[model samples]
Target: MPEGSLYRMAAADINAAVVFEKVSKSFGSHVVLNEVSLLIPKGAIMVMLGPSGTGKSVLLRCLVGLIKPDSGRILVFNEDLTRLDDQRSADRHKLFALRRRFGMLFQDGALFDDMSVGDNVAFPMRQHTKMSEPEIRARVAENLERVGLPGTERKMVSELSGGMRKRAAFARAIALRPDIVLCDEPSSGLDPVMSATLDDLILELHRTLGMTFIVISHDTAEARAIATHIGLLYQGKLQVFGEAHTVLQSSHAHVRQFFERNTQGPIKVL
Candidate 1:
């Protein structure tokens, strides 16, 4: 809470986990996002759904500063990230500190193939904390076990199956015990049974850790199973945003058509 700062501020009592205000982004001739705004409450799982190239992933990247928006503001816990100018020494430090609070699980898991499964999980703890090797090892084991991959520290990452790899990535994402976790397409490229299993793991983690989760996903069933809130993005704009049941049961033909994977809907086929 700075004295009289222009940083976008949420109410002290609102307890919003993340807020985006009139955010817009474009790449050359293509507009990826247009005045997108949404609120993610703490301890809630918000599933963002859209077709490919609809800018759901871009929206996540913007929050973590991977891609800067062309305009507008993004706030985490009332701290305006968009206002944190990296050219200033103090602001740069603040930006780094703010980012360290986020844990991200990439779409493909993005584990280092050369690193052992245990070492991969320990990577964040090693870089971010002064924890001893023994402590790091213990945390790695604990996280692996929690993801239902118990005692997998000695195994090579290349040896694990696709589902195992995703779960391992989830383990690494939580290694820092972050305030919020960002997951991009958690169920992508997995069989239906494995996807269901992964969805169960997501629900379990949310229940136990109570961390705010914003997940970008195409799987309607997975989103319905795990989301406390659901948002739909279409053509550089948000079409709908609401609680899971309300959004899922939407009378909007596009919403209903999307969930049903219908070819005849408002969403244009590329």
Candidate 2:
């Protein structure tokens, strides 16, 4: 089956792929995310950009329910995520059901080196579905081909190059064909060519399949190429959020300098 079919089967009914309302998270006295509020429209590629330690990844984790906010509300697919405390909750099953609607592509590939590429890609389906071995085999092949990594099924993850590994992980991420694909630095460690390729792939997926992509990347080149919208986070708050060109052309000193990559700006030099 084509990957688009899988995505259609997994797309959520909620109009917004993700909604954060006054969300705050802290590690003791250190506040990482403060009142971060945004609504990511369905099928849009929204890139969150900022310097290191600006909590971009933390917010991504929060979006995926990996980290709970200390306060405020997160509604994924219109379900109050905070209420998924346990199986006893009335909508717990439904909330968990939404889990399949999204997938994550980690910064480091995050693939198990011990497993072959095919096995790695098949991991989620194996864990979540009752599909037979042959069915999984076909699905993995289809996903690998979609990411331009056909016949990589038996290759060990360690054998792949940085770009290949990223692509492989991307293949795995989309194997389940999630409607919402949260990518944390998808092109972090790759060369310019590879990064561009990755960005192009994301754009293709977005346009062809209407996948909602939430990318957390400091790679300006990558972000500029693929993001339909942009959000800039600084000092535990969103400094700006809007359409790509508008936010990129903001008069805000911080936003300007950040995009320009100049030494002098509102970004305090430590």
- TM-scores for every predicted model: 0.95, 0.92
- The residue pairs found clashing in candidate 2 are none
Question: 97-128 in candidate 2: lDDT tens per residue?
Answer: 77788888998889999999999999999999
List candidate 2 segments past 4 Å from native.
1-14, 87-91
Candidate 1 regions off by >4 Å? 1-13
At residue 117, candidate 1 shows an lDDT of 95
Over 1-270, each residue of candidate 1 has an lDDT whose tens digit, in order, gives: 121122244423267888887789999989999888777888889999999999999999999988899998888888888988898999999988888889999988999999999999999999989999999999999999999999999899999999999999999999999989999999999999999988888888888988889999998998888999999999998888878988888897768988988999899999
lDDT of 2 at 5: 34
